[model samples]
Target: MMTAASSSGTAPFGLSVLDNALTGIGTSASEAYREVIALAQLADRRGFQRYWMSEHHAMPGASTSSPQMMLARLTGETQRIRLGAGGIMLPNHSPLLIAEQFGMLSALAPGRIDLGVGRAPGTDQATAAALRRRHDHDDRFPEQIGELVGFLEDDFPEGHPYRAVHAVPGPWQAEQNRVPHTEGLPELWTLGSSTYSAHLAARLGRPYAFALQFGRADVTSALRIYRDAFRPSPALAKPRVMVSVSVAAHDDPEEARRQTSSTAMAMLRMFQRKPYALLSPEEVAAYPATLDERRVLDMYMANTLHGTGSEVGVALERLHEQTSADEIMLVTGGHSREIQTSSVELVADHFGLPVGA
Candidate 1:
């Protein structure tokens, strides 16, 4: 029988700290930045392959509303871990700005930066309006992706130069510096909750990271589509698929539940309102698990691989065998930095990965 340790190929796993849990501790934005810095530092020392932040606007639960800025800061703070956005919501900003910001980050961090793009607006209609009023047609993500790709590749037409040439932190500097991005541009990935992203990743020949932490009921279907549709581009020799799983770990199961309760409740509330802060363990235990909470928990348990070291090892092993995913990206949401850090440590040790406290 195949044990958890030897069930799949030993591909490196990455740590994705998206929707990180620093907000509920009364940590201000600056403090949250520091906390993320700490997490990145720890992850780097832990031998995790990458540390990705995510983009969300007007959400009290997450601080990565500006992934570009956070990337720069994380670049300055950490040493080895590949740092980038788990995804930058493309509709929220201009592709040129995305290019510029990531271009600068690539220049600074050189080989250590990545820029994952997603098509979702990352917010509701009203908030989306607040971000880019009257420019409501930003759903043109496929077109926008082409524009961003063109800017990065410097493949824009060079006719009489009639167009205002929308290239920010243009390719000249990046090319000159010998930055090694995805396809010599930037290390890019596509984030999706459905088969759309999977098909896109396969078609584009870039790696795809599924946001299963907040995904719907079609995650397995999405992954199947991605793997089947994957086409090898010059950048990738074969298909690379990563699935995101929610994580909450401690030495004991009860302790793990205690640690995860607040975040669990927060996820429960998301069905009605936007994602918000981590709740207290006491508070989470006090609230009766509603039908919505139970439903969310069922969904979460189905998609997420959680527990202490041994249990998570088994779960991860089963996931690797089941999905054949190239990599597993864990979304650690907790109310305390200690729990957040501990979650990564548990996952690391179970995989025989070099771990740090």
Candidate 2:
């Protein structure tokens, strides 16, 4: 369950950020990382509920391959905004290691850490093979989630084979040593773009985050399934839903649309199995796309909310009404730092989010 501290200020629904740390055609990966810090600080001061980063592997365009490392850096950069993995692709790593990493994060910023896990590989099949090295654990996602939760909670059944294994610097460690520590653990959330994840989250009674930005799943139906099938657990008493949407907003509507074109083209290239590199608006404008590619670009743009800040705000409100989501997370489109920062500020202002909080 979300605490008042984490959910405050945004009254009707919480507003948060999900960053991919995308590098533009001319930008370096280091610069992209620095921008991420700046954005986190800006979001922290502007009162966004949470600042989360996604994990992707072998994507030259996306620099956030290790969300844990970035979040560790954020523990000192921001004072209030919650820091989290928008999601960690769990099949690529050990559940025990993730437990330890997040446990350390909890120690660094108690009551301000979120661990959202997904079943996807977050990479191509070849890269997934390279990461797991013949494990092929995608089908074992549910069991891995269970093992992760058990490690975090330190409550594995006595007969379990791994019952003796404990994640150090975790709850179990603190209790065993009677060490004085902070009062909270990393809040676990389930991330998905389908009803399967919704059902799993419901059965486990964890918060659910639907990735509407993926544009491949029905958000409304998945959220409904989650709510209808929810069963309370010790971690959460009722269903909590967060919907993430792609957005590009600015004071000037045309600039907003232009900003979205870069990401739209990037999505188009991704569909073509080409390198998913974010191009500048100028480059996107000069590209000669085929009819089929144009269709894909148009479809991508149609799914993204783009316009003036007020227009985007209204669209988000409509989405909230449609999905009855407890939180709305913005995955800002485009790779321009100025546009990204401006969109967040403008939308924050439109929503009347308190500043300097």
Query: lDDT: which candidate is best?
Result: 2
In order, what is each prediction's RMSD in angstroms?
3.9, 2.7
What is the clash count of model 2? 0
Q: All candidates' TM-scores?
A: 0.87, 0.95
Q: How close is candidate 2 to the true structure, as a TM-score?
A: 0.95
Compared with the true structure, what per-residue lDDT tens digits does model 2 show for residues 206-280? Answer: 999999988657997899899999999999999999999999999999898888998998888877777778898
lDDT of 1 by residue, 124-210 (tens): 667888887346454577777777877776676657232445454656554566874432457878888877788888888888888
Query: Residue 348 of candidate 2: its Cα lDDT?
Result: 86
Residue pairs whose backbone atoms clash in candidate 1: 182-186, 182-187
Measure candidate 2: CA RMSD: 2.7
Poorest 10 consecutive residues by lDDT, candidate 2: 1-10
> What C-alpha lDDT values do all the predictions have?
0.71, 0.87
